[model samples]
Target: MKTALQMSLAAAASLSVFTATAAHAHVSVSGPAFAGATHEATFGVGHGCDGADTYRVKVQIPAGVTSVRPLDSTFGKAVLEKNAEGNVTAVVWTKPLADVLPADTNYYKLALRFKVPDAPFTTLYFPTTQTCRSEAGVETTVAWSDTSGEHGSHDADAGTPATSPAPSLFILPARSPGWNKYTVNQHVHDLSVFNDALIVWAGKAAYSANPATQSLITTEPDTEVLSEIHPGTEIWVKY
Candidate 1:
């Protein structure tokens, strides 16, 4: 909807692109959780390594997330691994040697619920590893703990570059008045979130939904300057 207000947008600087995990059936997570909210993180493993059967699954708990409790799974009870200071560091799920299935026949979903920290946050990834073993005593492992690369908060048309992508979670911050800096976890197209902000600044462009401006600086033809929100976009919004 075009409003009567003239919005003046300008270019800022060049930026890198971000691609989140979605199409890949290997490993992934669910989120964009609100700051300070309790979240249940689920790690989905679709297959074992090199056609071997899965034997163990380990997931590292990121900082600031509190009160983590692993949910039960068919693989058995969840084992808590802690740090020297008595803080739980990771969660493990193991399958007995006799129960190891062959190849990709099994899909595993292991989850842990925890309370998120209050805002002044962005994206979080729980580094996970999947270990597989064969009857002959051969063990193969695939670690989905890479935290490199970038993606849009919207997780748009792009796919992750990680061969074994870790399950990721996004944090939606608690906004404050005046200017607030945020990273986009989900793609945003509507300008409503910044409705009252005087102007928003992303990489090489600026957006103002103040409805009192008089121009546009669109990078793409027919698309608004702020239309494409990157997965890891750190944008500044003013109230």
Candidate 2:
């Protein structure tokens, strides 16, 4: 007889397979808040380079979400640039002089402030970009994380860019009154022959419902591909 856990695992695996095949690149929005609450949101990025690729990122926010601007970023320097709309501006990160980020450095932080107006706060969506560059300054991989973990966090695997059996997650909460902290994860993968990497295409995400733990549901996505990532590549971008 199959054990109860085994049966459950099989079901979850089947669901994951379905999601992986149908996955697409998209952004996820999560929110429902009052006018005075501070809102914190964390964006997740998965996949990084070993010594081969350097990454630069830019996050764009919707209009009028908050009057507050982004403070100094932990990952790098941020500058306010006028958006296409002309009057509105968004925060953009300035890349360092270094052509390539050191192999050991794999994470960055971007903190923003959201000051709500007298009106009620509703849903806000942030669209972002990831630029991957090679030593020759050629572009490599660019990806974004949308889904939230139970609390809204994602793990990025640097260098490899291969999908694991585990599902990745990121979170965006509704508006609140004070400043909130959003933590993001970057997974480093060594896509070099010395590091040994597997190329894979990411599929869609699928979820499993569990009654025991209302919030502790299961999710799975499929990433399958075959090709070695080019060496000396990094990502760069500005919102």
Candidate 3:
């Protein structure tokens, strides 16, 4: 016979992924990547600046993400910018003037293959800048590089609308068919995203349907509960 906790955990789902793609959405990256795994992030561009056709797109790669290689884009040539340390700092895709005619008013997806950091439960942001050119030869740019607030404030996928939001997404641990263990690298405020998770716990702290009833935890005594899980805090979940 199976234990109640085992059955509950087995039936539970993995972590939650939050995105805020409302009106005036900026450049956004899409994916549910596993920790330390290779990911091909696709940044989506909806439109140009004030009806101007897109000419270039530059995406800034955050730290801890390694071995980045931008894929070829039909829109233009993809190039990478690297720091003195030999790490890729940014990936820029520029469309040729030949194709810019009649305005490349359509949406675009710029891809980059790389390895996410080993830290699980971390949200990484790729600050991006989009350049546009008008038929009259006027040029403009949109800096989608504000990585503040939830999921990098003003993100097209989540959080309060911002004037400029960075492209961001969570890199979580690879889960098995049953129960899985994870140690979060950031503070998570809401546990509701894991609604399917039957329970979550760390040390003596545990939560079933509400904030963990423990006063303090052995793992991370200060922030160990469903409502507030701090960094370096180890937790287990049912798949």
Q: Which candidate is the best by TM-score?
A: 3
The top-ranked prediction according to lDDT is 3
lDDT by residue (1-239, candidate 1, tens digit) is 13322223222111111222332326767554658878777777777777787889998988887898999898867999988978788999998777887654788788889988774335577888888888677898888876644322323323445555566665656666556888766665444344445667786566765333414444333435666565678898755
The parts of candidate 2 lying over 4 Å away from their true place are 1-34, 40-46, 49-54, 83-87, 102-105, 116-122, 141-239
Ranking by TM-score: 3, 1, 2
Question: Candidate 1 local accuracy as lDDT?
Answer: 0.65
Mark the regions of model 3 whose C-alpha exceeds 4 Å error after superposition.
Answer: 1-24, 101-104, 152-160, 192-225
Task: For each candidate, give its TM-score against the true structure.
Answer: 0.64, 0.40, 0.75
Model 2: lowest-lDDT 10 consecutive positions = 191-200
lDDT of candidates 1 onward, in order: 0.65, 0.36, 0.69
Q: Model 2 over residues 86-160: C-alpha lDDT tens digits?
A: 633556664564745644245444556665433321123355566666566666544443322221112223323
lDDT of 3 by residue, 87-141 (tens): 9999999999878855655998889899988876667878888999999989998
* Cand. 1 TM to true fold: 0.64
lDDT order of candidates, top first: 3, 1, 2
